[model samples]
Target: MSSSGRPPARTRARVVRRMQRAVPALTKTTMARMQAEMDWFEELDAEQRSFVSMVLQAGYSQFIEWYDDARDRETARATPPLSAAVFGTAPQSLTGSITLQQTVQMIRLSIEVAESELAAVVDPDHAAGVQAEILRYGRELAFATADVYAHAAEMRGAWDARLEALVVDSIMRGEADENIRTRASALGWHGTGDVAVIVGPAPSDGSSPEAVVDQVRHAARAAGLEALGAVQGDRLAVVVGGVSDPDKAGAVLAPHFDHGPVVVGPLVDDLLRAHHSAAEAVAGLHAAAGWPTVADTVTSDDLLAERALDGDPAARRTLAETVCAPLNAAGPDLMLTLTSYLDQGGSIEATARVLFVHPNTVRYRLKRVMDVTGLAPADARQAFTLRVAVVLGRLASNQR
Candidate 1:
């Protein structure tokens, strides 16, 4: 063998000539065998099948040229690398139509056909030389195949990120429609369970948007949920699905945000209705700073008092409907008792005196308020929420 990793000129010429003569028949035989062995090949449409045939022919022709070049040191030095040249004749789209495993199987079949045909045609003295070249060429082809798939995977990941951002943005803007659903379908967002939205500051450490999204997705998966995240202005918004508990899901994602309150909206039916949750979460996020002791994962309902004080109309409506309307429906006595109890600084005796009833009666009415509204009067936070609801309810009545 020569230092250039080829047999001496005389022997190299014979082997190259034999390979050139055998390539056409070898390519035909290999394609026929591959079709017979792999059911997937037969399933491809005519256009795709023709494309595969072109790639097989190209691979064979390029291998012969590469082997001939290898025999001549100067030609080998002048030519592009064998791996790059082998796939250059075929379209990159072939990677999409063919799986990597299928591609490998095709390559193996081609090599086998080439070896068998060359062995029969070439001189017995030069068989070893031909076989060695086939092995070297096969290794280079395998590397080229791997590079193709790696590039495809990277392109796919980038496309997915852009699509995910668009979906999340549409949800936040309350513009979700069929187009948004189509995009989410492409992303495989099959969460048919509850969905919630969480809002907080974007990370301040200058991480790329993709990195931030990946971190949130990883955290969500760890907690058994699917998540879509985007950096909208200074805020990081994540819509988590398949979880009934927004607070629990929000806790998993809280660390991905900057140091601040992470507000979670109520759970909704699915991605299409996620806009309502997104709206509530954003409103709560804005109001969250007002409370000094706010929990890291505060629910939008928990922030109703602050949201109402900040003039959020939705919060006002929630207070009026969910809190005041129910109590008012229970009876004027319950409403009057609640108003007196809050106005009198949560004093049962004061409320009883104002209502001209026994203290036990006031306590009973308070329990009735809890039963009607789901808010306990004894808790300070619930007391504040009740007070806001009463004020908003009276104001709404005056306007009507």
Candidate 2:
């Protein structure tokens, strides 16, 4: 009976027919809208699907007020491959993948189907409430997709770490497979020629060790070398192979930024030896000159080891300062004049021509330098000493 105390038989039958007609229309409309969405779902690779599924399910449960933790425990029984795991594998065919956009549309269509059936059970005005619920559910699904993407990012990171460990283990054990080799090759590692290891210091702002290792690997590749990168705490270690020129390699390697300091170990003949040398070289930095901090040349640190072992960074600093102070204080004009004079075999006339100054001005500056730094232009030993001093001074200043 209607609220007006009239029989509702006719009205009910009419409502039922209206709902019956609406169902097919809604289905057609929804199917058309959702067809593209399903195609989108099928477009996801396996890794993407795994991430998206988790996120979508989270939203589903939240909207329906279901206990997701319990549901997750049940779903986890069937292991979903992590997104990071498959990056090393053959790229999946879109044989079975789904996108977030499609998943949302599917859920929305399902809600519309539910609402169409509900409309027949109530007044025409009650159908408006069902529509509102469908809209709300659609919003939840959209947000769920975003959550899934973020989670997938974290999963990819963890997967990469695991893959890196496996790759390093294979190379170190000398049992690397064709696939590993292929991956390495794609990354520009060729497994030929001598390999050098580079260990860089920690950055003051806590630079990412993994990023540094990858950078070194990239540098080696760009130079047509084979390489691998690893992180040990704040330190970065790169094992390089297939490089023909060590000096040239260093030049190729220089642009990579590091935190504390970078140290290059002696080159090794094979991957295993390269790994050992790199690890030792990185450790040597602590026992070398600067300990916790240093730069590109491990040789300098090795030279200062005994003094550094006695905890005398100040001595090394003072020695460097004493050698380079004169050239630094002399300014660019004197330094250029000195360089030109050295190039001219210490000829004042040649230096004057190079500097576009009077020969007397060159002579005057030379005299002033000798007066200030006790270095005579005529003494070969003093000149050599000054040259090394100047080089060391510039390096030390750069460290600051």
lDDT of 1 by residue, 1-400 (tens): 6775557878777777877887778877887897899999988888888777777787877777776776454543645654467666667677788899989999998888877787777877667767777787888889888997888788888999999999999999999888887898888788678999999999999899999999998888888789889998899999898987777888889999999899999899978899999999999999988899998788999999999999898899899889998998899999999889988999999888888999999999999999999999989989999998998888888999
Candidate 2 colliding pairs, count: 10
> What global local distance difference test value does model 1 have?
0.86
TM-score of 1: 0.89
lDDT tens per residue, model 2, 112-193: 6545654544576545543554465456445644555556656756666566655665544446456666655554456787
Please list the Cα RMSD from the true structure of every candidate, rounded to 1 decimal place: 2.9, 14.5
TM-score for each model:
0.89, 0.42
- Which pairs of residues clash in candidate 2, taking residues 3 or more apart in a chain or in different chains? 41-97, 41-98, 41-99, 42-97, 44-97, 44-98, 189-226, 192-242, 202-260, 203-259
Model 1 clash pairs are none
